[model samples]
Target: MIENLWLIGIGTGSPLHVTGEGMQALRDAAVILVPTKGAGKDDLAALRHAIVTASGTYAKVIAFEYPVRDPSLPYIERVTAWHDEIALRWQHALKDAIVGGPVALLVWGDPSLYDSTMRIAERLDPLPKIRIVPGITAIQALTAAHAIPLNTLGGPVQITTGRQLRAQGWPSRAETVVVMLDSECSFRTLDPEGLLIWWGAFLGMEEQVLFHGPLAEAADQIEAIRQTARAEHGWIMDTYLLRRT
Candidate 1:
């Protein structure tokens, strides 16, 4: 059984995005687990290694091949199975290191956000004492890069995924809706009238791209840019904020 598991948020791509506490956790970890998303995504794994190195940590780094979900399975079933497999992978990765000391996993954004790390951790046979070392979230990074506040004069802000936005349309009474994990550019399905969008990709990274304008005018351009960027770099993680203008 894993003794202690530290879910450290490494933020987007910058090592500086890791907070002082996260850095210290890295330094203190005996073994760090890094997930490799197969071919064409080596940069993602490399970045984690670089982050660990930057922390000046001599901890042993173990890389595991992340499992791909089955497309045939329904959404909930597929995700549940995927998480189970990931939990099994974590167990296998730490088979020899449980007694070493605290084990750490570098998460891409805050664990409490849309991440499933905590849920995956629970699938472990004997749950380890889990500790979260919070770091900069993508939302924070996005807003900072845009120099915009998340809420509009104390108005409520709703955060949802592209899937939910596409399925539920717009949430009523939401002055601001922040969309994440939207590969489809789901905003295209919206009316776009009186809507303003501030979008950012690879936020907090050197290769970040941003666009802001009326949704009606900027949706197509944003999608085109997203397509080109995804083709150039095997993957892309982006988020956008929509406000009623």
Candidate 2:
């Protein structure tokens, strides 16, 4: 039988953000696979290690370098190929670490939101029974940091990516849009006449930055700050909320 795979959401690099259930999941894991993007991105893996160490889970923690996607390929194809590579990595790591037992991965934010770990896990040859221990998401972190509600009154909200905003423009029927994995600040491509934006980086962390204003006014500052932060940290994960005013 395939071992159980636990996709545990750890939440925004804050130990306090981990749920009790998530901690228990970590404690129960026989092996935990942590992915590092490279030298400059070691903090991502370190944060996972910190949590595991603090939890006193006693699980064998193994760190592996994450495979990079080829940007020249079509976006979907590139992502699919990357996921396949990641699944292979997971299998290799599990084989070396766990004899035949439950394994866990500490996913940033909630695994369901813009996270492909679940999809990659599904590709395992003998699929393991999957369990998701959800944690706080960056969206929730952003809204809480800014003291704003995600939706106005009873209005609807759409969650999307930077690429979609650049290609399709503002979604016609939605009043609010939450954009994630955006490096381009694609809201600048839209007609800012009736739009208000709330952008946040490093949400729920001490280094969090938030800017809220008319899209036109905040776009430049957001871009500048984003560039500076990315250069300083060597990587960034930012999300923004746009509302039609």
Candidate 3:
């Protein structure tokens, strides 16, 4: 029976982003779960392995194939089913690895932030005690790469996904917004006038890319860069911050 489940955030694609606490958790874990999401994402899988190796963890690192969401199902239903399948895989992997006392899953960015790891963990029967080891987030990485503050002075900041931005447009009365998990370049859906954008891809990693300027001027360029990077790498994780100029 699993006694402890650790959702350790490793940050966006960088071993260096693993915190001292996160490293210690790796060392203490009995089994570490690494997930591979099939073709076009081998780099991500390798990076996870590299992180575990770099941490010098003696724990057993078990790699599992991640379940792909069914495209035919509606978005919410598809994601729900996918998470269920993943939880089952996690159980199988954990049991196969050992009589798990403490198992760690390296999360890409903090588990609390737009990640489904926590939800999947909940699906485990007799839910194990969950612990989260936080790491730097893509938002932090994006802002740091551009040397910009997250919010306008004393103003509220809105953080959302690309889907929401596309479906709902900008949040009302919000001066600043951060977008994550956006593959569609949703910024194009909005009128670029009076907007400034700071965008980054593969943040905190060697192939890191950044672009910033007036949205009207940078939208096309950013989209081009995104397409080129995605074509070359086969997969891309990007985020951007938009503010009213």
Candidate 4:
């Protein structure tokens, strides 16, 4: 029986973003599962490996291949099946890696925000006790790196995804909306009038990039830079906050 299953948030990209609590969690686990999305995107896997090595944890580190989500299937359906496969992979890796762990899986950003590690873990049979060590989220990093406050003077803030923004224009409720998991620059679809945007790619890493201005003026530039970065690095993780002026 497993004692603890820790989903440690190691922040967006920077190893420095690993929290002390998360580091301790790594040290405690017997097996550390680091996942790779195959080729062209091994940087993430490397970063996860670096965290484990830097933590001085002699615990067995297991590197597993992540299941690629089929874009043809409906988004909901694809994600459901993908999670199931991922859970199965974790089960096999944990079983082979060792017995009775306190296993740790380093999650990107905070598991609470737009992450599915916990959801996938729930699918495992004979579930183990769970512990979460939250790290900095992309939005927090974005605001911090750019030196901007998340909310404007007691104003409401809503966190959402690019799909929602594209599906239903700007949200009618919140003065500020932070969008994540957006490969598409959905802000271009909205009326950029009176809207200010702060965008960042690679959040806290060395290749980090930041851009901000009126959405109308900066949207194109952002798209171009994002495309170039993705082409260069083979993958890019980004988030942005749009504030109504």
lDDT sort, best first: 1, 3, 4, 2
The root-mean-square deviation over C-alpha atoms between each candidate and the true structure, in angstroms, is 0.9, 1.2, 1.0, 1.1
Where in model 3 is the C-alpha error above 4 Å? none
lDDT of 2 by residue, 119-189 (tens): 99899989889999999999999898888999989999999999998999888789999999888889989
Kindly list the per-residue Cα lDDT of model 4 for residues 59-171, writing each as its tens digit: 88887889999899999999999999999998877665556668888999999999999899898888878998999999889999999999999999999999998998888
**Residues forming the 10-long window of minimal summed lDDT in candidate 4:** 92-101
TM-score of 2: 0.97
Q: Model 4: runs farther than 4 Å from truth?
A: 1-3
The per-model lDDT (C-alpha) reads 0.93, 0.88, 0.92, 0.90
lDDT of 3 by residue, 181-229 (tens): 9989999999999999999999999999999999999999999999999
lDDT of 1 by residue, 34-74 (tens): 99998888988988999999999988999898999999999
Who wins the lDDT comparison?
A: 1
Q: Pick the candidate with the highest TM-score.
A: 1
All candidates: TM-score? 0.98, 0.97, 0.97, 0.97
